[model samples]
Target: MAYVLTGCVAVIGSNSLGLGPIAPEVARSLGSTVPTVMMAAAAFGLGTAASALFLARHIDRIGSRRMLQIALALLAAALVLSALSPMVSVLIVSQLIAGIASGIALPAIYSSAAAIAPSGRESRTIGVVLTGWTLSMVVGVALSAVLADFVHWRAVFAAIAILALAAIAMLSISKYREVLATESAPLPLEALQIKGIKPLLIACGAFMAAFYGIYGYLGDYLHHGLGQPVSANGLAALVYGLGFGAATLLDNVVDRLGARRVMPAAFLATGVVYVSMALFGGSFTMLLIAVFLWGLANHFGLNVLIMRLSAIDPARRGTIMGLNSAVTYLAGFVGTAAFAPLHTEFGFAVSTFVAAGLMVVAVLAAASRPTEAIVHTVQSERQLQ
Candidate 1:
């Protein structure tokens, strides 16, 4: 789990750190506009969407740890390619490859973690693994910005590649050998047809659409829309990162409150914060608080949703997790694409409210379903196995 967690953190951090701030610089170097250059981000997400559905079942059949290793190799290659790319298209392609690699690694890791954890502890286990992800955001973007100030962006990519290689090497050690050999159940797409899974997926979809819509655009909103200084933007992100990190620690609390109760509260809080950010993004202090609260609620809700899915079919761990990530990236693409046009025409307030309302719909969908004991039994068997 630690090895998987470490690899996930490196992948998410490196990619996220370079996403927003580097866009304009890459565009300038490539002789392009921000929108054109932003294709790199979209291309990356497209890779995720493609890989998750296309390769997910195979990943389950083959073994998640094996897929994870392959993903690391691909990520390393992509990072090196990104560092050396002279053309904007090449950079976009490289990032797309990296995104696919991350897409594979994430689900594999989460499924492996869920499989190994004790009964009814999937949430706590996922929280631990996700902590590394949150920590990476806290450190990755902030450090990347600081490094970009002192060094070149190419150097940043090179450094991330080196770090990925190191994590890959660590994962190959004997201590993690067991994970590589752990058995998982065959893919069960039919289970997805079950009535309960439908509402669950819908709830998750709406939640992610809203969450990523805001997340993908927050830095841009702060920098361009709100007129904040670069450092201020980074500082606000730090607050957001802290909120994500803090939410991971709330896993037990969430479990106690029940996924049903906690989810609605989180959605409502995050939605409120999004509305607040949209309304007062111009106020530095006010925006900072809003960003923090937004991060807190959004992350708590997302992790809980992930735990719910992990429990749904514990046997088909890798496939389900892969689907989870694939669906998430797909929704992210929808959110990012939707927000671009909305921000251009209707402005942030109207668009943010719409996103917030989507979250409310998610909460309602979650409310419609009752948690069942059959899912709990599956979770137990996975843990005991």
Candidate 2:
């Protein structure tokens, strides 16, 4: 189950991060500008948000396994379309389709992870699954850079398609088929009204906006602001991904320190790193270090958030997770779309600080009473155990 969940998430990561490293090159090839090409990211996020809002409710009714299979098929088709796209519009549409697939797939995977997780080890199980996303940062973003530099950007999508197909094959095995037979309760609309959910959703939105705003443009920033070669984009992403992957090992730390204490700290630390990037990004070493720290803090905070949300309502885990995904991706869309203009008009420093400010807001929001509620909830669950 863990392996299957990881494989599914890896496809999501590839589809999400695949275009970042090659945005500039794709723009050049399509006779467009970098900011224009970046719209694909926004489109993808919008699609994901839409799917999470409208389609995710059906996951519990249809069963996670079936939903995952449908999502994988969508992803495969989207990748092929992306590879074959002749115009920027077509590429944007392809990305949108891929994003919708991811939105549908990821929440199902998360719900499955929660359902099958061993008692007292739920966070660890979810963390292990999320590591697939971090690995995607390496394999998807980093490798895309190398491939884009050597072969062509189109090859990146083709590679992702193959991986998606592999994941489908893995799911087709008899063991997974048996797992998919289990049915979950339908998602309740009242899940939205659960205590602490609203604030957490707000925090997630702010955090994603801040994080993706910088990340969506990191490649162009390195090329334009630091005057680095195209290859540096992938190398920097690799370093950041390594940090993210490494941080997953510390999921146990969240259990020890408690999420209430850790989440605000991570948000604060990530904010500082974002500001540092703004101040010292001209130095390649400093930029790399800041990016690494950003990934580390961001992923830690995200893990805690996921664990908390998953624990909120076991019966509605799918719904809560899906809504969480929707909020995050909507923020991603806004951030990516907003950053392009901010960076274009005021340059990297201003844009970076804008992101940092959003992180600060997220920190404040997360540190509020909702966090206390989460801490109490976790403590109550542990006492029951």
Which is the leading candidate under lDDT?
Answer: 2
Error of 2 at 264 (Å): 1.4
Task: Assess candidate 2 and give its TM-score to the true structure.
Answer: 0.85
| Model 1 Cα lDDT, one tens digit per residue, 1-385 | 5545655665666675566777667777778788777788788888977777667656666777677778878988998998898988898999899888887877877777766666666567767777766667777766666676688767778878888877677667635433332454444465465335666678878888887777666666777887877667678768887887787677888767666677677777777887887788778788888877877787778777777777766556566777777778888878877887887787767778888898888878766764564576588899999
Provide TM-scores for the models: 0.86, 0.85
* Global lDDT of model 1: 0.73
- Could you tell me the lDDT of residue 71 within candidate 2? 92
Tens digits of lDDT, candidate 2, 66-159: 7888999899999999988899999999998988998898888888887877776766777788889877888767788788889998888998
Q: lDDT scores for all predictions?
A: 0.73, 0.82
**Alpha carbon deviation, residue 32, candidate 1 (Å):** 4.3
Scored against the true structure, residue 296 in model 1 reaches a CA lDDT of 76
Candidate 2: regions farther than 4 A off: 22-39, 86-88, 145-155, 174-191, 344-347, 370-385
Clashes of 1: 0
